[model samples]
Target chain A: MKAYRLRRGAGRTALYIAVIAVSLMYLLPLFWMVRSSLMSAGEIFLIPPVWIPNPPRWSNYTKALTTIPFGRYFLNTMKIVVFNLLGTVLSSSICAFSFARLRWRGREFFFALLMSGMMLPGAVTLIPTFLGWRAVVPPNSYLPLIVPAWFGGGAFNIFLLRQFMRGIPLSLDEAALVDGASYPRIYAQIILPLSKTPLIVVSLFQFLGVWNDFLGPLIYVNRERFFTLALGLQMFIGYYTAQWELLMAAATIVLVPPVILFLLGQKFFTRGIAISGLKG
Target chain B: MRKEEAYGYLMAAPAILGFFIFTLGPLLASLWLSFTDYSVTNVYKFVGLANYKRLFSGADPFFYKSLGVTLYYVALSVPITIVSSFLMALLLKQKFKGRGLVRVIVTMPSIVPAVAVATIFLWLLNPDIGLFNEILRALHLPTSQFIYSETTVVPTLAMMNIWTMGSTMLIFLAGLENIPEQYYEAADVDGGGPIYKLFHITIPMMSPTIFFNLIMGLINGFQTFTQAYIMTEGGPNNASLFYSVYLYREAFTNQRMAVACALAWVLFVIVLLLTLVVFRTSGWVYYEGDRQ
Candidate 1:
């Protein structure tokens, strides 16, 4: 009995050490990033290296902001994020309702096609899509980014919203229909209200994706003034490649808004992803 | 069903229209472009199977070499990520202190932008005075000339991928929670040890999630680009030259649109075949609620 008790105690201690060790491996890069960002250029490369700065260069933040068109990039990113988030949430929910609650011609066939889009690598269609956009849209604007999202470009969002809509009992939609409500009215009053969780999930996901998107802005927005935070960060690296401190400081600044928003809304983020993933 | 069908059609119209305009239409367009010697200059010119012939015949050494490098990455990354996440998930499943904080910190990296993650990793892997190399030297270990050395560049990039295992770990955690305690309790009653319980019960039950994560990880690994783009730019003697990175260079830098389109199609075919293989194997997976 004493041997068994000792074995258990040893096992517990080992497990605690392992977990703490692994967790530190994950945190070390982040810690190093912030630490380096606060040091001066020469100090960043100090031998027997400095884990913490003797005097943190808080001015690195100001220098980072000044180097790029940080203000304009933030505005551009906000524009894409807000518009894309709004369009994705509303359109996806409506389409999902149609797939879940409403029956229409070729519903299953179309539904199958939409699911197929989930597996379709965006890389495959990227070039041709860009060329097509150049053909149809204005030469240079945020139109390419916002327009397709409005049209339900990727089916994952719609598919997710659809599953959640399906899980809802049919009685609600039927009851509204019996009251002589129009399809639009049923959708607005009935379907929309029940899908609050998924809508937030879809919206949050779209916001994060659009905000951090470098490829889209890189492809469409050629002008420096129209660059997003991602593009600004990219240009920051190009200009400050040698300046490790300044580059990291710039990246940390760029990384702040998304990280803060995610931490604050982590509950919703976790819950939303869990529910959607189960159905997925 | 008829009235409902109409509504369904109405509902799906937006998605369908969007798919055709954005996805299907472009896919078909690119397929045609692959057969021709298309460039931004002429935009179109039929050239038969010349581009594909060049790829298979090793006419473009960089093209074939990049494909090999990418396959190497997938082979190395998928298993490491799966095993790491599985172990971490198992550790996390036990009742422990600071579980919430650990989970939060683990997943924090995934939500951050790829660029942000890449930048941090670049700093971490920097050769002179970088923390990783510094630690090695401090402990009297042989330090790697990372990012600058061709031998270590790809391996280093693969190592950086270890940080983002948080997403898969969370998914594994969710899968772990759903596993009924009765399985382990019954095993314990039968005098099964920890390793025995893990092999006979935990692993078999977790197979479905494991399979899902494996396929997803493989797919993401094959499509890796953002890090290579910002970090090494496929440098240090092309050690980190990933397929997508090469494709980007072909299309954007070299203006070889036809070759780029061909490369993209080949990757699609490879991914599709792997997905099918996983699906076929998934039948053996043991679900808790489903009886044999």
Candidate 2:
């Protein structure tokens, strides 16, 4: 029995060692990012890379901000992201409720059509979508970005929320109806309350999509000042091609907030993904 | 009936309108534009089947080359992702201290914006003075210009994809949880060891999640764009030119909308077929409560 206990202890130790190694591998790049961001450009490319900067240059952060119209881009991204988040949440939840709870004509067909949208490659429609946006909105407006989220731009979020909503009991809706509540009221009160998890998940996805979206901004918003952090960060690579410090510093700033958000909200996000099978 | 119809439309109005204008409208317009010699500057002449013919005939090097590269990426990324994710999932499933934290850390790379992630990785894997090479030098191991090399670029990009395993890991974890503890208990009672339990019970039980991940991964893999756009710009010899990147170059950069559309339709058919294959094969998947 003692020998068996020792064997189990050994197994546990072995497992932990393996995990520690893997974790280090996972974190190495991030460690590198922060370390390199602090070094002078000359020191950054020292033959033996500096693992730690003895005198970390704090100016990289400031230079990164100054190099591009970082403040303007940040504001643009926030504006676009906020509106996109609101639009997606409203559109996806309302549509998801309809698909999941409300009875309708051609419901299955429409549902299937919506699902088919998920299957269509965005590449197929890139040009047409661009031209379509051009036709609808005057060039360089946020309409192209904001309007789609309001419309259910893509069906992934709505479908995910729909699946989540299906698990909600129909009795809630029926009871609300019987009690002289309107469908909208029931949706606003009962369904929305119950849908907090999926709604948060959809909102998070929309936020990430809008916040991180470079392609949309690149295509529609050609003005340098209107660039998102992602596009603005890309400029650091070019403008300060040799300045690893400023670039890394800039990259870190853009990268960190979303990551912090993910870590904090990971549990809810995981629950959403685990349930809906949509994150992939 | 009219009232009910009105309510249904009212409920569905947002999604339908979004779909029609954003997707369906664009899809139809793109299709029409495909039949024309349309550039952003040029008001397009009807050049029916010329672009389509050029694509299949391998007359356009970009079309064929990008298709090949895209296929290569799909082949490399999907399998590597599946195997690595499965292995990592297995490791996480084991009882360990700080398992929760480790899972979260592993999932971190996925949520970080792709552009940012690519930038960090681009620096980390830089040929000179990059940490990856430094480690190799310190250990007296060999390393090369990974991202810069044509031969090595795709595989390295695929390796970076392992970080995006949070979504898959969550699925695998859920699948692992759903696996009844009784199966393991029975295995133990029958003198089964960890290996036996893993092979006989864990895999079969996890097959559904695996299937879901497999299909979704393939679809996502085929549509891979941003990484190619950011990391290599499809090249040191066009080695990393993914189809979507190629399509972008065709339509926007080169103003070859027709050819790009042809390529997109091909991709659509390919993805559809792959999804169908997975669905057809799902019959073999085992479920706990399911009966023949």
**What are the RMSD figures for all models against the true structure?**
1.9, 1.9
Local accuracy of candidate 1 as per-residue lDDT tens digits, A1-280: 9998999999989989987998898788878888988998888777878778989999887888787778878888888888877778777877888888876657788889877876777778988988778777775589888988887635878877877788888887778779888787888988798788878778777888887777788778878888888888888888887898888887887888988988887777776655544632
In candidate 2, what are the lDDT values of residues B66-142, reduced to their tens digit? Answer: 87888888889888888888888888888888999998888887787888888888887888867788888899999
Per residue, candidate 2 scores C-alpha lDDT tens digits across A16-100 of 9989988887887788889988988788877766678979999888888887878887898898988888888888888888888
DockQ of each candidate, alpha-carbon based: 0.64, 0.66
Reference-based lDDT, residue B38, model 2 = 80
Best by DockQ: 2
Pairs in clash, predicted candidate 2: none
Model 2 quality (TM-score): 0.96
In candidate 1, stretches whose alpha carbon ends up further than 4 angstroms from where it belongs are A275-280, B1-4, B281-284, B287-292
lDDT of 1 at B143: 91
Error of 1 at A195 (Å): 1.5
Q: What TM-score describes the B chain of model 2?
A: 0.93
* TM-score, B chain alone, candidates in order: 0.95, 0.93
